[model samples]
Structures are given as C-alpha cells and as structure tokens.
Target chain A: MIDNLLFLAAPITVSIILAGILSYLGNHILTRGIIFVDIAVAQIAALGTMIGLLLGFAEESANVKMISYIFTIAVISIFALTKFKKQVISQEAIIGIIYCLALGTAMLLAERIPGGSNFISKTITGNLLWVTWKSVLSCLIMFILIGIIHVIFRRHFIKISDSKNGLPYSLWKTRAYELLFYITFSMVIVKAVPIGGVFFVFTLLIAPAAAATLFTDSWKKRLIWSWIIGITGAIAGMYLSFTMNISNAPAIVTLLGLIVFLFAFIKLATKRIVSHNLSKEKGS
Target chain B: MTGLEFMFAPLVASLLLIFITVYFGIHVIEREIIFIDIALAQIAALGSAVSLVIKNISGEAAGHDHDSRTLLAYLFCVGAAFLFTILKNKKIRIPLEAVIGIAYAVATTSAVIILDKGAGSDVHIHDMLTGSILWVTWPQIIRLSVVVVLTGGFHYIFRERFRKVTLSYHGVDTGLKNPKLWDFIFYMTFGIVIVEAVNIGGILTIFAFLIIPSSISALFAKRWTTRILIGFLVGGISTLLGLYLSWNMDIPCSPAIILFLGAGLLVAVGLRAINKLFSHQRQSR
Candidate 1:
C-alpha cells in the first residue's frame, strides 16, 4: 500500500503544478475567447508527434518537437485568417473544423502504422499516471520560464484575449505579439500533451479559470482563485481516481467540471435572490 | 458490388447532406455558432453511450440496434441544444465559445467514463467521431432524403422568418435572441440532421460538409439561391473527386473528401484573389 502511495505521489504533484500553470493560461484563454484553442492545437500537435514517430524520430527527440512546433505554427496561421476570424463563424466552430481536419489527417497518416490509433487516444487522455520525475522536472522548468515571460510581459500578451474583436491585423501590431502568444500557447500544449493528454490539459487549462471568472473580475484575484481551484481540483481528482480505481485524468476532469458548474449555479442562484430581494424592498 | 454502386451510394448520401447543411450553415454562420453541430453531435454520442451502457448492464450483446441509439441520441442533442440556448443568456461570465468548449468537454468526458465503465473499446467512440463516409448504405440514403424533404419543405414555408432571424442586419448586429420556440425549431432541425449524418458520414465528413461548402459559397455569392447553388456545386464536386481519389489511392475515404473540400476552398480563395487583382488592375488602368 505504501509502495502505491510512493508511486503515485510524483504524478499527483506533477498534476497540481501543471494545473496551476494551465489555470494561468486558462485565464488568458477565457480572456482571448479562444477556449478551444488548446484542444485544437493539442490535436494538431499530436498529429505532428505521430508523423514524427512515423518518420522515425524518437518520441523524445528534438526532431519530433520541431515537427510538432512547425505544424502548430501552420495551424495557428490557418486559424488566424480573416475569413475564419469573421463573426459569422463562432470561434469554436472554426476550431471544430480545424479539429476535424487535424483528426482526419492524423487518422489517414496513422492508418498503416501499428497501434497508430491508440496513439491518438493517448494524445487526448494522456498517460498522466505514468509521468516520470524527469518529465515532471522538465515541465517545471518550462512552466517557470513561461510564467516568468508572462509576468514580465503581462501587458502585451494579456491584451490579446481582452481585445475581444478584430482580425489579426486589427487585433495587434507587428503580428509578432500574437505570433508569440500562439507559439507560447502551442509550446505549452506540445509540452503538456504527452504527460497530461489533450482533455486533461484542456480541463486544467479552462475549468479553474472559467470557474474563477464567475466569482470576480479582478485579474490578480481571478488568477489567485483560479490557481486555488485548479490545485484543489487536481488533488481531489487524483484522490478520487486513486480510491475508485478509475483513470486519473478523467477523474480530474470530471471533478473540475463539477466545481465549475457548482460555481455557476451559485452565481446564478445568488443573482436571482438578490434581484428578488431588491424587488421586495422597492415594493415596501 | 460494382465500383459505380459504391460511388453512387455515398454521393447520394453526400447530396442529401448538402440539401440540409447549407441552409443550416447559413444560420449557424449568422448566429456565430460554428461548433453547434459538434456539440450536438458529441451530446448525441453521449446519449448513445448511455444507451450502450444500459444495454451492457442488461447483459445484451453489443449488436447494432439502430432505432434505440438514434432516439437516445436525439434526446441528448435536444437537451444539449436547450442548454446551449440557455447558456447564451447574458448573465454567463464565459464567452460563448468557451461555454461550447466546456459543454464539449463535459459531454465527451461523460461518454468516455460510461464507455470505460462498460469496458468497451474506444473504437466505437472513434468511429462516432470519424465515421465511415464511404460505406453509405441504401437505407441510410432513404432516411437522409426524407430529412431533406422535410427540412426543405419546412424551410420553404418559413423561409421569411428564418431569413429575418438569421440574415437581418439588426439581428446580426445584436446577437439574435434565441427565443424558446425559434431556438427549439433551430436545434430540433440541427439535431435531427446531425443524428442521421453521423450515422452515415461520421462526424468529420459531416462537419466538413456542413461548414466548408457554405463558407466557400458565402465568399462570393450575394443571393441566397446563388449561395445554395455554389454550396451544392462545391460539395458535389468535392465528394465526387474525393470518391475517385479514395478509390484510386486506397486512402481512408473521409479524409479524401475533407482534403478535396479543403483544396476546393483554396482554389475558390485563389480565384477570388485573382478576380480582385484583375479588378484592381482595371481600376488603376
């Protein structure tokens, strides 16, 4: 029993730390109105990883990372177009189309490889439990680096999400800033997807930030609350999965979901009560 | 079966989708609900997952019982549609896209959990997402045709309302208020078509058919009929070309269709670019 605890301790810690970083990114995702970006980018990233493996790059090789990075850039460019930027198509819809395209391309590319399809599922669900200390360490370094970049240049990158409308040209100058953001964003997805999987990464990336946004508008407070929720969700999820003998990633996602809905409901209910009380006071 | 038969059947099904998807695409584009079909499809898949779980719990063999799954899927989709409409309520803090993303995550995770519990392979879910567009069965074609007729008739009758709601300048400026009745009608129609399309074409092919054709058509055409024609033309040619390439290259079929549509769009965009260039030159001259 103690051995199991020893084995899981590293993974659970990794998930919490990862969740914190993801929540920070998640706030940006919520602000940018590009919540599905992580999923779509992750899928494309996975496809790139698959093709890298197909081309005989060792999974951990720089070649695989390079290929995946290039694919992500191409995908970001495709999605950056004014046509896709139109208000006519919901941002999620464009993401969906891009998602389907990447999925199809991956499937077609992987059709002949042995266990290619399993690779696809693994990309989404990730083998969160199997994460090693080395990988966790690397993730830690990357996160700290990214966190520092974010802290130093908060004004530039955060605006991408808050701008709310406009094509890439209208949205930012030099296009360098937006490009940097997507590259940074895609870098996180590529790094995290192998350990956490697309769905888990996405849950970590969106849920805490989403739930926190419901409670307050202050960016700093929202960031703090978001990390708290994310850390809590991760620990709770890991515990649930461990006790229940279920998959860890799904457990984490399901828990995060419940917390999100709980927050939404609370917000909804409080507003209703306040409005009702206001009406009664006015009548009196 | 002959090559012709294989080609003909899928084309018929693709054609049936063209009829419904273009009209719905216009509304979806107008409403900025591009991911609605995916959400609805995922939700429908979740319902099917529930039914499949029930079937497993009852110790039934995993046979393809079409009706029960379809019915369950419909309920799940409409329920999702209702939720989506409600989520569009102004009070929510998240952007609508983020909400759609969350809905997608929850439904998908729920499906995964149910399937994992049932000890089912992921193949079923993967198939639900990618679909076998090439293996279009005859019965499926007939069902889709019926949908085409029903949606076509209803759309013709209520074209004005749909037009006013979907295309009016004011409605576009301020997001269309998805009143319960109109929203229900919208989701119901979208739900029915997606539930059926997923069965035949799979999610990827169905999505490609839904978004790409209409997007290309909208690029140039101003008139509604012209847009519909352009959509049909793009999809038809893409489908035909995809079938031919898939047959020849032995590539997985749906990707072929997607590739062709993608290529077709690029060509359309190129043509538009060239036209603009020529017009610019003429003006400068």
Candidate 2:
C-alpha cells in the first residue's frame, strides 16, 4: 500500500503545480469571457506537435517543443491582431474557427503519419499515471518563472481585464500586454498539454476558478479559494483513481466538475435559506 | 462505384449537414455561444462511449448496436441542453460560456475514461473526432435528411419565438412569453442537429460547417434569409472545392473540407478588408 501510494506522488505533485498556474490564468480567462481560448490554444499547440511528428521529429525532443511553441506564438499573434473593439463578429467565433481549423488540419495530418492515432490520443487524453519526476521538476521551475512574470504585471493584466474601464495604456501597449499574457498563457498550455492532456488542462484551468467565483467577489479571496479548491480536487481525484483503478486524468476532471457543481448547489441553497428568513422577518 | 457516384453520398450528406448546421450556426453566433456545438458534440460522444461500455459489460461487441447508442447520445445532449438553460440565468456569477467550456472538458475526459475500459478506444476516439465522411452511405444521408427536415420544420413553425429569445441577448425585448421554454426548444433542436451532423461529418467538419459559412455570411449580411443564402453559397463552394481536392489528392474528406472552409474564411476576410479600404478611399475623395 505504501509503495502504491508512493507511486502516485509524481502525478499528484504535477497536478498541484498545474493547478497553481492554471487557476491563476483561469481567473483571467473567465474575466475576459473568452473561456474557450485555452482549449483553442491547446488544440493549436497539439497541431504543432502533430506537425513535428510529421517532420520526423521525436515527440519529446527540444526541436519538437520549439516547433509547438512557434505554432502557438504565431496563433497567439493572430488572436491579438484580430482583437477588435467594435465587435462585428464576436471574438468567441474567431477562436472557435481557429480551433476547428487547427483540429481538422491535425486530423488530416494524423491520417498520414504512422502510429498517428496513438500519438493524437496521447496528446488529447494524456498519460498522467506515467509522469516522471524529472518532467515534474522542470514544469515546476517553468511555472514558477511564469508566475513571477504574472506577479510583476498583475496590475496591468488586471486592469485590462476590467471591462468597465478603458485600457490604462495606449492601444499599442495594451496589445503588447495582451500579447504577453497570451504568450505566457500558451507557453503554459504547450507544457501542460503533454502532461495532463487537453481535457485535464482545461479542467484544471476552469473548474476551481469557476467554483471560487461562486463564493467570493474579491480577487485575492477568489485566488485563495481557487488554490484551495484546486489542490483539494487534485488530491481527491488522485485518491479516487488509485482506489477505483481508473485512469488519473479523467478522475481528476470528473471530480473537479463535481466540486463546481457542489459549490453551485451550496450557493443556491444558502441563498434560498437566507431569502426564506428575510420573508419571515418582513412578516414579523 | 466510380467517379462522382462515389462522391455523391458524401456530397449530399455534407449539403444536408450545411443546411441545418448553417441555420443553427447563425443562431449560435447571434447568441454568442459559439462553442456550444462543440460542447454538445462532446456530450453526445460521451453518451455513445457509455453505450459502448454498456455493451462490453453485457458480453457483446460494442459497435454493433446503433439504435440505442444514438438514442443515448441524443438523450445526453438534451440533458446538457437543459442544464445550459438553467445556467443561462443572469444572476449567475460565472459566465455561461465558462460553464459550457467546463461541460466540454468534463464530457471529453469522462469519455476518455469510459472508452479506456474498452479495447478499441483509439479507433473510437479517432472516429468520434474525424468521422468517416468519405465512407458515408445513402442510408445515413437519408436519416440525416429526415432529421434536417424535422428540425427545420420545427424552427419554421415557431420561428418568431425562437428569434425573440436569441434577440433578448442584445437587450431587445420582444416580450416573448416563457423565453426559457423557447430557449430550451432552441437548444434542444440545436443539440439534435449537432448529434446527427457529427455522425455524418465528424466533429471537426460539423464544426466547420456550422461556424465557417455563418461567420462568412456575417461579414456581409444581417437579415436571416440573406445571411443563410450567402452561407449556403459559401458552404457549397467550399464543399465542392474540398471534395475535389480530397478526390484528387487522396486526403481525408472531412478535414480537407474543413481546411477549404478555413481558406474560404481567409478569402472572405480579405474581401471584407478590401471593401473597407475602397470605401475609406471613396470617403476621402
């Protein structure tokens, strides 16, 4: 039992690290109301990986990594360029279009390459149980570095996401900042996709942040609650995966989904009770 | 079958797919729930995966039972549509789009887990993603048409109510009664169309069919009939180009079509830009 539990340490630790940066970015994405952007970028990065494989590059090689990074950077630049204020077409539509085009192209490539179906499935669902300690440590260092960058630009990032206020910087500077956020965000996605798969990355990014939003209004408290919820969900998911003999990533995602639902339910129940009491007080 | 005979079913299937998907896509864009089709597709995929697992447990090969599997998939999509209706409340703090995104993630991961228990998870996953548009059959085309006609008829009968509910998003109060009821109807119909389209075109092609044409139409027109007309022209042209390219180059039909649609979008964007530039020049004179 101890050995079995020890075997889970790397995956759990990787989940914790991912949950950290993902929850932070999740707050930003949710605030922006472009919630699908992460998955879209993740798909673009996966398409990049497919291109690397098609070029005969090894999956884990630095060259393939660079190729995916380049792909995501190019796509992010397009997203930034397409950011229009007048909103003739919704940004969500643009993101969806990019996602489908990328996915379709990837599917096309996957058809030709040997073992391509296996490779695409691995990228989509991930193999969290087989995560190594070396990858975990490397991801930790990279996430910490990105976390520092976000910390340094927190005010600017936060202000830009505040829809009520005009941008604090000039149009060019704001675009630059937006570019910075997308770059850092895609960097994390390109890394996280290999570890947790696209679905896991999306769940880690959205679930806890969404749950935290249900209970709190302030950013700080929301961040705190998000981390707490994210960590709890990760640990609980790992535990369930071990006991139930299920795959790790889906277990984590399903638990996070449940946690969000539970939070939403609690919020609804409490509001109902409070309103009930208010009606009684008014009658008195 | 030789030549166009081989391509006929897929061509008809794609046209039928465009027929309903483009209509739904316009509504999706109008409502700003752009990713909703993908979300519903994922849910339907999960439902199908569940049926596969059920068949496996019952000591039968998983892929044979089409009727129950499709039914289950439709049921899952409708359930999700119902949930989306509730989550569309204005009082909810989290954006409905976020909720839909979360639903997509959860549904996909759950499908992965369920399919993992089966032997042919990879093939199933690939089929769910890319579909077999080239190998589409006349029967499938017939089924898809029945669904399209039924859904189109439903929308036509209550077009006014459905229009008002979506317009409500822009703060336009047409004073429609029980907008939630109409909203549920709209999403349920949308969900049904997606499941059928996904079966024929795969998720990616169905998405392309739904989004690309409608989006291109939005570039030039505002009225529903005009927009859908342009959408059909754009979708038809891209489908023809894609099928021809796939036939000539021996590539997968669905993704090839999707790429062509994407190219069309690029061309449309360029045209819109050029139009804007010429108008600006005219204004300056």
Pairs in steric clash, model 1: A32-A161, B131-B202
The TM-score each candidate achieves on chain A is 0.89, 0.93
**Candidate closest to the true structure, highest TM-score:** 2
In the range A1-284, model 1's lDDT, one tens digit per residue, is: 89998999889979987887889989988886666788788789878888888898887699988988897888887675533344544555567667777887888887866778875676666667889998889889998888888888788776656755654345436266666667777788888887877778888888899988887888899999999999988998888888987778878887897777767777778888999999999999
lDDT (10s digit) by residue, model 2, range B92-133? 688778888888878877776676652223533455777788
Q: Write the per-residue lDDT of candidate 1 for residues B1-285, one digit (tens) a residue.
A: 688876888777878887788777776766656666777777888888788888989998889997788789888888877766655544667765666667777787777776774222362356566677678788878888888798779878977666765554233543445444566676777788888877788877878888888877777886788888898888889888888888888887888888888888779878988998999999999
Local distance difference test values of all predictions, in order: 0.77, 0.84
Task: Summing lDDT over every window of 10 consecutive residues in candidate 2 chain A, give the lowest-scoring window.
Answer: A162-171
**DockQ list for all candidates:** 0.49, 0.63
Report the lDDT tens digits of candidate 2 across residue range A52-137.
88788987799988898998899989887776555677777889999888888877787878877565566566768889999999
lDDT of 2 at A7: 88
Give the best candidate by DockQ: 2
TM-score of each: 0.89, 0.93
